[model samples]
Target: MWNKRRRHFESYPEIVIVHVSGYGRPESGGDPKKCKRGCYDIISQAYSGWCKLASTPEHEVYRLPLYAGNYVTALFGAMEMLVAYIHAQKTGEGQVVDVAQFEAIARIIEMYYTQCIITLEY
Candidate 1:
């Protein structure tokens, strides 16, 4: 879904902006050992692909931050959205949607490109 959306936006340059949320989540389920392995595999694949595509001569794959504060990130995201909306209203253009965690996760997979391509599910 994300790739399709990206392509759509690329094709239609009139898409002035995009506001996305809930892109931070643990991408595995159940037992801790399996979850960790699964998460590692998923992240490794993503990083591998990113490394292949990156145009910069030098690249670094940084680890995700381990924050002690539980809701601080979410609060920051809300503040960002608020500021973006105000800016958009002042400028009189663009759109904003409160994307949920599940929706955001679903979009990250390459296979899910068809979801956005064939439906408005996102």
Candidate 2:
């Protein structure tokens, strides 16, 4: 796959690219407008499909628990894409913009970890 893409890029004098990684590309991934708890849970849950907020076909919003950093990251990613798009339009160049689900969680976790480490001294 890499070789094929490299060959294709040979045609362009110097083409720019924008890359992202996640459950799937934002285009292939579900719509961000109406994202749900299920979408976020896919990555947040250590055990996949293990602890789900009880909801029926007619979901009762009041019953839903807020296990939702995934949604926050998804929305943040969309915002980043908008900025990247504007940059590309103005400069006529593109760049890679990766937003991995686990990676985003890891970042948040590390910040928390740092706090724990700091408290250890006290």
Candidate 3:
């Protein structure tokens, strides 16, 4: 469907498409079965290691109830869409923005961990 629409890019050059997926680009290389599987908030959380961030004192990992992975993906997607929109407006060329939920969650998790380490008391 997107491939077909891409063919008409010249017709609508200002189009800024934002695609949000659970894993990532289907062709980016990974388990083919996982690429085809339907995604949920919890699935992305687990895949991105977001669940591991919320462990008990015993270190038993668990998922958060706030759907942080899903929300983060959406926030990232919206930001990308805005950037793409700006580019389209300037160049009169359309662009596709792909936001992976797992990667998005991983990004935030990495940032948080980095900050924690930076502020860690010696």
Candidate 4:
């Protein structure tokens, strides 16, 4: 007989967990060099597309005021996790995961390619 992992909580509920627990320097105001080109725009489009595809009912979703805000939150969350993992691996205190901005953006557009390929088949 196979054993299954125990559920953390009974009656599992759907939720969006944005994990942003890690250390890093916050961006200073009006810093041009601190910003990355086209990254913000890409993330915004990805986030909006994600929200649109979410299974939750419209009434239950909390839409962000601006797509830029969503992008920043997602970017920060990814950075936090990546930094923590890197710190841990170097010091033998944590695991490291390499998440490049370009790769992440490419993953977000996987469906776009699928759509392009599939639509032509019809």
Q: Which of 3 and 4 is the better model by lDDT?
A: 3
Q: Which residue window of length 10 is worst by lDDT in model 4? A: 1-10
How far is 17's C-alpha from truth in model 2 (Å)?
A: 7.2
Clashing pairs in 4: 88-94
Residue-level error in angstroms, candidate 1, position 3: 7.8
Candidate 4: tens digits of C-alpha lDDT, residues 1-122: 00111231122222122222112112222225423334444454443343333324544433334554445556755776767656655664433233333334445656865675677421
- How much is 101 displaced in model 1, in angstroms? 12
* Deviation (Å) of 9 in candidate 1: 8.8
- Candidate 1 per-residue lDDT, tens place, 30-116, comes to 234432342332343343342232223454543223421213334544665677667656775434334233233333444545554
Which has the greatest TM-score? 3
User: Which residue pairs of candidate 1 clash?
Assistant: 1-112
lDDT for model 4: 0.40
TM-scores for every candidate against the unseen true structure: 0.27, 0.46, 0.80, 0.29
Total backbone collisions, model 1: 1
lDDT of 3 at 86: 88
- The TM-score of candidate 4 is 0.29
Model 2 Cα lDDT, one tens digit per residue, 1-118: 4565466456542344444343334444534542322335445433222122232346532222465556645765776678877876787655445554544545545654555467
Of candidate 2, the 10-residue stretch with the lowest lDDT total is 46-55
